[model samples]
Target: MKMEPIEINEITGYWTFLRNIDWRDPWLIGLIFFHIFTTTTALLTRNRINFQVILFLTLLSMAYFSEPINEYAALNWKIFSKQQYFDSNGLFISTVFSMPILLNCMLLIGAWLYNSTQMMAQLKSAQMKQRSRKEAGIATEAKKTQ
Candidate 1:
């Protein structure tokens, strides 16, 4: 039997290609949960460098490795034969995977900066309460002195 060179669309149907937008795809949506799970794991284990490193590495490896494997299987098996996806074509999915991890890292570093905005409000309320307490304590102090 002779072989045929695969044109991109031969691998994926054009109609299948047009069907879903980024967030609507099943895998991309599944990735949202993956991101949240991985992000939560990364956040909860702050004391151990090894755990954080391992989790981050796991996320990286999944992005770099698991995604390609998934795509290959889908294409080869004709699971997604209706749509063609190259690693490059999947820029959207790749972005989706990266967003949560990137945001988690940034949130840790930026949360304190954000907290500063509220710091003055918190301190002023606390100070006002303390001032009222001190003003009201004059009678109690006189009784103690007596």
Candidate 2:
């Protein structure tokens, strides 16, 4: 028995549909909110809006969608193995399981990149200020000697 793969759109739609429902697993909802907030922070602080972040956002959203996927799989997916039936998590772990892990890792990497960019920008500004001060000092000395 083969488990049907959940479509990314379906996952998104699932979240949308459930958004109105107050009843939800707190653990899953908390995870979703945390990822969303952190990813958004990364996007705002990111130095360059390149294709890489775009791809990362795509995957991040995909990760957001997986909560529904897990729910659907638990309720709907039926795979037969001997006398016992294992769920979707039993097989194709990489495609399904790895998605959320990748999402979390990407969020962390994005945060790091954003913070590094901010630090470098600050360093550059400081160097400019120091150079201006040195130039002013030299000019003042030249006038004093004259």
| TM-score top scorer | 1
Kindly give the number of clashing pairs for every candidate: 0, 0
Question: Candidate 2's residue-wise lDDT over 14-108, tens digit each?
Answer: 34423423324354456567657655655665555464466566666666666566556556534411111123543332333445557655765
TM-score of each: 0.43, 0.42
lDDT of 1 by residue, 15-58 (tens): 43334333454665676787788667656665555666666666
lDDT of each: 0.58, 0.55
RMSD of 1: 8.6
- Which prediction has the highest lDDT against the true structure? 1
On the 0 to 100 scale, the lDDT of residue 120 in model 1 is 81
In candidate 1 the C-alpha lDDT for residue 4 amounts to 33
